[model samples]
Target: MVEDGASYWRRNLLIVWISQFLSLMGFSFSLPFSPFFIRDALGVSADSQVKMYAALATASSALALAVMSPLWGILADRYGRKPMLLRANFAGAIIVALMGMSPNITAFIALRMLQGLFTGTMSAAMTLMACCAPRNRQGLTLGALSAAVYSGDMTGQFIGGLLVEWYGFRQAFLYSGMAIGMSGLLVLLLVREDFQRPAPVIKTAETARNWHFKLGIVLSCLPLYILLMMSAFARSVDGSQFALFVEFLNGGVNEAGAARWTGRAAAAGCIGAMLSGLLIGRLLDYFRPSRVARTAALGAMLAMALIAIVPVHMLGMERVALDIGAFGLYFHDQAAPAVLALVPLRFMMIFFSAGLEPVMNVWLSKITPASQKGIVFGFAVTWRSIGWIFGPLAGGTISMLWGVEAIYVVGPFFFLALVPMIGWVLRKIRSRLES
Candidate 1:
């Protein structure tokens, strides 16, 4: 018989929550401001070139992540999820530090690919929590865990902006790397996992079909995979292009000024995501995960479309000034009309789209057989990587051709497409349950 899922779940969940917070904070410190890094540190300065390179940088990391997530997931299943978490943290610590000292753009992009190959503390933590948490409380536990992600990103962006402004990009990266290393140490010392190996199957002629059996796991959940990928794609189209959009709105006049504002805007979105993570968890506990996800997608779609059409100078946003305190430490300029209009929409889009991954995770965990959890979550990461890959490249292409603002115009179509795909997956899930 399987052991009790709740025996050590609460303690383990708390440890994982704290560790992932540190890990993601380290990530956001450098990544959210990479466009500036590419322009300032790596010496690539043409407006269009910066946008393309930034997208390329993001897509490179995602490509490596797409390639390696499944292998890591399989290893997690075989060894233990905690080990995977430790591995991700420690490896990320080294790679990210190196990114700070990169000699050229090529080296930075290469390290990013390595970053994807080694780090995914979030997936590892989620898989561990899913396996350990009590069945009835999984939604609550996972929701709390998702909150860690957004909260950490929020905290990191808030502080990282100031850190970058105060120190330099290199210092921020070094600091973030140290923080990730600390997360690994926490997991190593605190979290405990009582991993039970899958029971061995009888050796028979069916052995030749091993690959086929694993492929079946993916095929059965193809629709869910598609929904997750599409959702990821929708979010990326906006996010991967945001830093450049900030520069565009401010007319590319000030670097430090743009960085500070970008951080504030990103932090606002994370606030929305943190709220979404918690609220969706509560809603998921009482409602169908699929239904909740659909509602969120609809909200995300509307918000994104509104962002594209909203009046840039409406509601007196120019007069909404920051509270004065740190003279010379912060920018004294008034908020741009476009920037002001987009921030709320950014929060709304993030609030809704942020619900997609966790809701999909909760839904997948519920529907999947226990034995398939590791591989499924791994594949989930892999599929989402496809979105990451296209999202950045697509953003770059749009910004190059039509303009940065046009990226938002095209974002809604992805969400609109996601609606039907999710409904189709829901139908398939119901049919499987009935049968």
Candidate 2:
């Protein structure tokens, strides 16, 4: 009977992992190219206008998400996590499809806001998995799910780039919607929840007195929340401008070529994230999650600094290949190695950045009562959305003022500054655990 129960939950985890991959992939399909979509498809040709509109689009979605996450989370806790996952997937499909049909930037931004308001597939999925998985394997389970997310995101970026090159930006949204719809279908068919809502409690003098203790628990978790915010901010600060940065690098390349290169770079980062998900997810099972997070943050900080200062040509190597065959057929190929210099650094950054989410999730799962998982995770998502809201806006304005490369130079500082806080939090968590 025990073995059967274990197999049952494991099967659910597999299904949820696949569903997360598809859902995230669908959302990311056109994300990397949104700025270009604004400039080209929306006819916003001015650089400043493009930056402003793109930033607005990014921030608006995050803003709505920030506002709505807590509400949805409470509902998920009261009802069941599966319904929330289904809600997000179905709503995301409709919103993304509508985005493809939008006639102007304003309409597009509105659709994106709706996407944020109704969809939080990641958080919802995480809640479901956390609730269902055995306590001892939370790290591994969440980490595996994280890998799926990165894999999906990487696949989406590459395919989205190709789609944009072939069919234009609008079509990417239609494809994204289709992918999300498939994910929803998978959930409807495969996912099972045995959630039982907590029984209502009667208020007593003792219960009223325990309010302060509950507040203390929330306060104790504040540092983790801050770390989540900083991690998100550091990563996203460069995200809005990354494609533009690639375009800047490829001075002579056509728009399609630049988009392709950007996709390649983004995909490389996602590969790093996938690797991290596998490695770090396991590490969390053995070590203090905060310690792992600290190491990753330091590595990411150094890599971002290097990425900012290093010349692309210096980091690249050249290779030539010659093919000889019958009938005197000979072909020679030369590759510019410098174009790939940032790929490794990007990998390093993403590897570490990827560690933050699952580790943080594991820690939260350990600290918070299971009954409150939905609301607490929702709060974490809110903090992430707040970071997403501000990071892109700040990145956009800075890119406009100091050039796109400047964002990279500024990004490392966000991580660098958070190291001390991380250390302090780790100590507090350890002290509490030991006592």
Which window of 10 residues has the lowest lDDT sum in candidate 1? 311-320
RMSD of 1: 2.9
Segments in model 1 whose C-alpha atoms lie over 4 Å from true places: 1-4, 198-212, 311-321, 324-333, 431-435
- Model 1, 30-138: lDDT tens per residue? 8899999998999997878888889999999889998999999888877778899999999999999899998989999999999999998888898888888766677
lDDT at residue 75 of model 1 (Cα atoms): 86
Top-scoring candidate (lDDT): 1
lDDT per residue for candidate 2 within 170-239, as digits (tens), equals 8998899999999999999999887777567579887786556656666787877887787788878888
User: Residue 164 in model 1: shift from native, Å?
Assistant: 1.2
Candidate 2 worst ten-residue window by lDDT:
313-322
